[model samples]
Target: MSAGEPGTGVRARPRLTVVSGPSGVGKSTVVAELRRMDPTVFFSVSMTTRNQRPGEIDGAHYHFVDRARFDELAGRGEFLEWAEYAGNCYGTPRQPVLDALASGKPAILEIELQGARQVRVAMPEAQLVMLVPPSWETLVGRLTGRGTEDPEVVRHRLAVAEKELDAQGEFDALVVNTDVKQAAAELLTLMTGTAVRKPWSSS
Candidate 1:
């Protein structure tokens, strides 16, 4: 039975699902699809010091901030977990997640493996779901297909992907994102209790 099944005499706890995977493994695409499928689900927008890529919205893709501001926030302990990847800083704010959970809403966070580990430390109840590519070659193709970053940045991410894949055992569940629609459907079931029906209602 799921955690919130009725008649179990157990109070339901809001789920904090941390969706993590190697860079370029379609984490954002799968997440965007999840949002499209279920708008009510809350996804934590992380704060980043990296420049926004083309087609990325300031507050949507991430809370893009300057290095100084990011450093200040980190120093002030405003973030739940923070990490520097490929020379850019990324972190999840603590308050919004806590507020979402307090309100009995399922919260989702898309972050790197390191940040996911930190989140695990802070919120042991949080469900860590790892989204993985079908194959290593598939990962390389996805990373190169973006054509957004420098060759060196791509290489660095590729190297990190190796370690990320090796650490998949750390996550509570593994969702292979070979198809965005299918993967998103699986993720929606994890976030909510229901599967992807035609109407897509969480009620």
Candidate 2:
């Protein structure tokens, strides 16, 4: 297939799906729930230059690499999508996603909005789902409740979340994340069309 939207001759549902939202939008929570609820799908693990957080396992949460290694991989065209966030670079390895899809399994990529845009240009046939918070107030609470970052960092994230929310229309679908399980179910259904949805609907 070409690196664009499929022609009229194509009928199969896209095997690749990109999930993106602003920081502190419960993306990690939803993804973890999705894994527990559906083992058949593939969730692409991203590589990042940021130091691993407490309780995070390398290769499970993210493949932690230094700046030089990350730059070398990016230069080699190994990343299908990549971007810098909070001064750290994150990228999705190209081959694993392709291999998963080639094996007839749906692949879910959790990335930033910038990387999602790159995926749209590179794989237009793939579905782009924008996950959002129930309301602006809830989003602020979530971002601040983490208490991991400084006040300045929290403000920056809230600003970025506002911009990401404005671009919701660019997505193929919108998923309001009121609860983790429901959001994951919605994402799973969007990818494979056969998930047992919980009690939640898109707004």
Candidate 3:
């Protein structure tokens, strides 16, 4: 898909939707569900310097680049938005997302708060959606329950979550992820600009 061409059966220009949240807020799970329900949505696969986790397939899950390559791309301004998280660099490549949108495919980006802000500045037309947990305690429980990180790391993530929650008003919409099915449905409605009412409105 290239810029300026509409995808099959899509007459309008595609929009770029950014999905961001604190770590361990079930963003991945929610996004997975969205993709399962609608495979036509173009989900941008980020390039990351972090090690690949189990069950994560390269090119499908992430680009999985090394630090050197990641730095090279960042230096050359190849990314639409990029940020460092937990010492690892993660970024969305510019060309692919542009191409997807140009081809009239709805593009979704799952990235961090900083990266989301960058996209907001660079692409003002992009829709910014924030996924929030039901509560702080619930967020902590979900993070710890994942068992993927050390206790110290979990603690750090929770701290970050607190800060992220405070920034909820910055997004175009906020969907509380207390129920995965409900939240996913809300997200779908948000992306499609349907009639469903969002829990939090854009400021």
Candidate 4:
């Protein structure tokens, strides 16, 4: 399909999908599965100062950069949205996402709640989606199950999750991440503005 031209079954304007949620709600899992199911969906790689975890590639997972470089980019107005979390700075570059959307490819941004809110203000047309767990207990289980954080860290994340959940109304839609397959499918549907089982009424 040509850029900005609707096809028989495809959307015209490229979709900008902002997926945000608490740290442990499986946002990454849903995004990974979406990319696997539809490779054409462009997933924007973020720039971060945090050290790479196991199995995370430099450019593929994130654009690993030093604090100085990150500051330089930020000064140049390179990031669409950025924030500091847990003593590390993370941000999304502006150019790549704009280019992808210009080329008629759906761009997916898996970011934090604050970043998502920033994008909503900057790009009103972008679709905002929040991934939620089935329940509080489930969310806590997923967070601790990762085995990547200590008790203090887990508690902090849960506290943050509670606040994030309270901001669900700010998003255009909310997809419960109880079932990975189902959530991914719903996300794809939201990105395309196509019909799937209605998760929540969009505001």
Candidate 5:
């Protein structure tokens, strides 16, 4: 939405919301559930310089690019927010999100904490939601059960997650993801200002 029209006093609706949490906290799963419940919501896809993993599609999961191209885009100020993670750079394209918002669709960004903070500064009206694990033990279990990384890597992730958990107070909404359905219901309530649906859609 554009700024208030000059001398018209017409206010614009805030349309962007950011969701962030520690790694392996099921941010992706929660967001996927939100999309399933509401097909109209526009989720922002991020760009990254990392190699694509199995079952990931470019432009859908992420806009995979080379480091040089990512740097070029960053230098051109085309990104709303950008950050380095695990030696790879990731960023959100500015225009697409604005376009989606301008069309009256709510734009949801699932990003890391650093990028979320950058979005907050750039768009103060954007809502920020923190998705947190139900407990430390649950978080550790989720991280370790992935079987994707070594023990050392899991330990490092847990350390980083501890810091992320402390930043929950900085968010506008805190959703505890003990149950995916319940957590998705809570998140949808925050996004749409509606009561959590009973018998939330499973199809």
Candidate 6:
């Protein structure tokens, strides 16, 4: 079929979507679930200076780098947005996201609130969506998981989370995460305008 023909279904021009939330709000889980449901979605992987953990693959989980290398890249302005977290630096490489969008694949950036602000400045057209937990009690429970965290540490985390949650109004969209699969499907639908098959019928 010729381009833009009446019978040919034209694909929507994919856009860049920035997904952010509090530290323990299950943003990673939802993004992973979205990936499982649709491999075509372009989830932007970040580069970090933190040491890779046991199960992390270098290029997959994150592009692990030394502090000096990270600094060099930042100085050259290769990152769309970058920030320091827990004494380590993490940044989204700008080109890959542009490449994915130019080729018509929705690109998702699973980042922190700080980085999301930076992205807003760098790419004003990108969509910003915040993932919020079902409730404060649930977030507290998730933050205190295993009960191994120091009371002081947990308190600090909750304090930060409160501030992050307050910034929901700044976002273009909000996804409440009661179930990982449901939230993921909703996010995918928002990004693509196409509903996906639910993993299970009853839920």
Highest lDDT model number: 6
**Candidate 1 structure quality by residue, lDDT tens digits, 98-166:** 998888788899888888999999887788999999999999998998888899989988998999999
lDDT of 2: 0.85
- Runs of candidate 5 with Cα error greater than 4 angstroms are 1-14, 194-203
Q: 15-111, model 5: which lDDT tens digit per residue?
A: 6889999999999999999999888889899999999999999999999999999999999988989999779999999999999988878789999
For each of the candidates, the C-alpha root-mean-square deviation to the true structure, in angstroms, is 6.4, 6.8, 5.9, 4.3, 8.0, 7.1
How well does candidate 6 score on lDDT at residue 147? Answer: 89
Write down the RMSD of candidate 5 (Cα, Å): 8.0
| Residues 80-180, model 6: lDDT tens digits | 99999889999999999999998888999999899999999999878789999999999999999858889999999999999999999878889999999
TM-score of 6: 0.87
Model 4, poorest ten-residue lDDT window? 1-10
lDDT of each: 0.86, 0.85, 0.84, 0.88, 0.86, 0.88
lDDT tens digits, residues 1-203, model 4?
33433334545466689999998888999999999889999999999999999999999989999999999999998998999988999999999999998887999999999999989987887888999999999988888888977899899889999999999988888999989999999998778754233355372
lDDT score at residue 168, model 6, on the 0-100 scale:
96
- Each prediction's TM-score versus the true structure: 0.80, 0.82, 0.82, 0.85, 0.84, 0.87
| Clash totals for all candidate models | 0, 0, 0, 0, 0, 0
- Candidate 4, residue 69: lDDT: 100
Model 1 scores a C-alpha lDDT of 0.86
Indicate the residue-level lDDT of 145 in model 4.
89
Give the worst 10-residue stretch by lDDT in candidate 5.
194-203
Highest TM-score model number: 6
Better of 4 and 5 by lDDT: 4
